[model samples]
Target: MAHGDITHIDIPVGDTQAARTFYSGLFGWDIAEVPGFEGYPMWRAPNQISGGGLAPRDASFTTPRSYVEVDSIDDTLAQVSSLGGKVLMGKSQISPTSWWAIFEDLDGNQLGLYEGVTSAE
Candidate 1:
């Protein structure tokens, strides 16, 4: 809330290989899949992660969304409706301490939310 630091960006494309090639050839950056994370490949930028990724249309994922990291996703979601935004997907756990959710603003701008920790009840 005090400072805005963009951790990374995620771009959605139909084909990962083609997208990777296009970006690599154009920007001279290496976008490769990390050995362990087979499917996920982070955009390798000179300074910060620029953005890259293929849409997992056929997978358990829905339409691609861009995630924004926040201190607490619950508070953000709470302010959604008041700010004329609607939650497309409720808070869900991605990992032991990571949470994500999809939402739509009044202008219909789709956004993804990410919280650092997933509280255990």
Candidate 2:
């Protein structure tokens, strides 16, 4: 993926199991629980091309948010600020090399940014 490309998406749900069952059966998506991410399960589309996560819903994060891939999280954040957007979450690591962050556009819609290896060697 490249900068501006949607890398991942996070959909908030009240019930993890029920959401998993609904999505898995509805779309035949492969939704499975990740080891460390217990209640939050990752989902892959039927084509097995697009992927994202099904997360527990909360007051501040109840809607589905898409993540755009960026080469540099810091740089992109700076650009976001310059473009009148606000950082809702600072760059944080999901792994040693992978990182993610959330932000709000001028209209207040929340979105995410992803920085790391997007493909396997």
Among the numbered candidates, top TM-score falls to 2
Give a tens-digit lDDT track for model 2, residues 2-118: 788998889999988898899899989898877767777899998777989998899998899999999999999999999999999999998767899999999999999999963
Each candidate structure's TM-score, on Cα atoms with residue i matched to residue i, is: 0.74, 0.93
Q: State which candidate has the highest lDDT.
A: 2
lDDT digits (tens) for residues 1-121 of candidate 1: 1213444456666677887888888887768775544676656676544554444445535455667778778888998878889998999986677887878988877888877743323
lDDT of each: 0.68, 0.89
Q: Give the per-residue Cα lDDT of candidate 2 at 114.
A: 96
C-alpha RMSD of each candidate structure in angstroms: 4.9, 2.0
Off by over 4 Å in 2: 118-121
Instruction: Give stretches of model 1 more than 4 Å off.
Output: 1-4, 49-52, 57-64, 117-121
